[model samples]
Target: MSRNGQRGQAAVPPAEFRSYYGRAVLKTPVWEWKIPAYLFTGGLSAGSAMLAAGADLTGRPDLRRTGRLAALGSLVVSTVLLIADLGRPERFHHMLRVAKPSSPMSVGTWILVAYGPGAGVGGLAELVPSGLRRALPGRLLGRMARPAGLAAAAVAPGVASYTAVLLSQTAVPAWHEAHPCLPFVFTGSAAASGGGLGMALTPVAQAGPARRLAVVGALLETAASRMLGRRTGASAEAYSTGRAGRLKSWAEALTAGGAAGTVLARRSRTAAVASGLALLAGSALQRFAVFEAGVASTKDPKYVVVPQRERVDAGIPVRGDDRAPAGGTG
Candidate 1:
């Protein structure tokens, strides 16, 4: 009814935003504390599963036992954490009741179910005495176990990558924008974690694959992170720049140090220890950086706007903008 309305003047500025520092703009995750706990447990399970597969293939029974135990323990912990995260833990069965390819969480649930049981059985087999095991086991038990371990190994890579997809599917700017690189980063971190565990437990002769895995994982992590930093604009600034920045930098340093030390793992016990410690430290730091970056991205509007605007200017759809709701959280 006013003159401004009649003249069709704008009601607000073309660009509007507010800072999110020290405040949450969206739902502050009321689900439960155990969600992140499950994430960590899942990562550990995936890492151990890989180690078990590698040991089986390499003819290291001792390493195989260690790896299988680690995998089983991680699965138990992960199950507990996941159930604790749900408000209706009773509905956990509903997870297996449905199949949805579009859902990363669903895919992860299936992977967990398959890997958990396989690892547990394999671990239990290792625990029983050979005579006792032979009494109940079929002639094909070893064959079945071998293939199951390999299946777990194949899924282990996805187990790491799927978590990234899970987070990126949400409204987190830093996470969604870095989806491509995040999977690779997480895969590398998982490999490093497994390698560290192997180095810590296996004898020098049996530690060959573990060392190579660590070196490859380190190189991959470093490259993926650098690419993420360069590609995502300010959305990924958290990865390289404050507390999160420092953590990411430290992760990189540790990864490099670990890779270098792995080369000398055969030389001496001290070198192996150093390498294992460095890789483990790097894994922890990388996880922390991932969470920190997600939180930081959610707290800043500039990160949401800048990248999308660039995309828009470049004639890209910008539909993947994290602020655009579920349709764009790709």
Candidate 2:
């Protein structure tokens, strides 16, 4: 009823309403540049941990040091990047104050705290040669070190995959909509980054597995990128038309070159090292480009509203509540 004793028109149809640019149809991005650093470091740590475990199981002590140190170093770097991103680094401990399955940050915080110590212990174990540790009174170091490395190893791959879930679960335009590619892209990035670190540190005489892993990771990244480029509308735009496109192209070149270089690893270590470095550099650029494209997409109201409006008109209701009047009366 109207205040004047007449019935009021039904509320204006929501579809009739429109917003200017950057009004934020989607939620704000809680992440920042440090998020990519976190991604990069986490990937490296997990991949290195896996290699360490493999070396241990295969009875290769020389390879063990490479893996352990890589894992521990990456963990340290990742933790630092994460804290740097926080508004209050001292309050980072507040994240561990609870367990929130629905919150990616909470889950990731717990994973990092656990993985950091686990990998650190594994790496420190490398300082003691097995034979020397065995000569001790209780054979104590050997007994404790081996088991700790094994446990960290068991958790490493999960650490690699969880970041994928973390990003995909977010409302970021490019990330959430591209869940399938997120995991594969992240996994490949991790492997490539780890391979780079290994090649940089490990002796040429024993970098065969690192080379192989690099090749595999590069191939996966290239393939996933193609799919990402094919995504329709807004998501596709991120991968094909701007700085992201340039970065993706560079990533492709680096990935291909690195993977191909692996074939010469046994005979040409220099080539292998160069290729690994290229892959790592490419991965960093790719992460930066994705971050930029996501922000661009969300900042433009057209990108946010157009496709979503199409969906709503088609009865799909894909985006936020339309502010237009209802029942086609507007």
Please, what is the whole-model Cα lDDT of each candidate in the order they appear? 0.73, 0.70
Superposed on all Cα atoms, the candidates' RMSDs to the truth, in angstroms, are 5.6, 8.2
**Model 1 agreement with the true structure over 1-330: per-residue lDDT tens digits:** 576676665888776444455354443224333554566566766877888888898788877877777777877887887676665677678889998888776887787777666777666666667666556474345557777777777777777678778877777677777888988888888788778777777787778877887787778878988888877667768677676799899988998899888878976767887898898788778877777777677656677667667777799885533333422221
Please report the candidate that would top lDDT against the real structure: 1
RMSD of 1: 5.6
- Over 130-234, each residue of candidate 2 has an lDDT whose tens digit, in order, gives 567767633655566677777887777667768767765655566555677867887787777777666656677777677767777777777886777666456
Give candidate 1 misplaced runs (Cα > 4 Å): 1-37, 137-144, 315-330
Alpha-carbon shift of residue 104 in model 1 (angstroms): 1.4
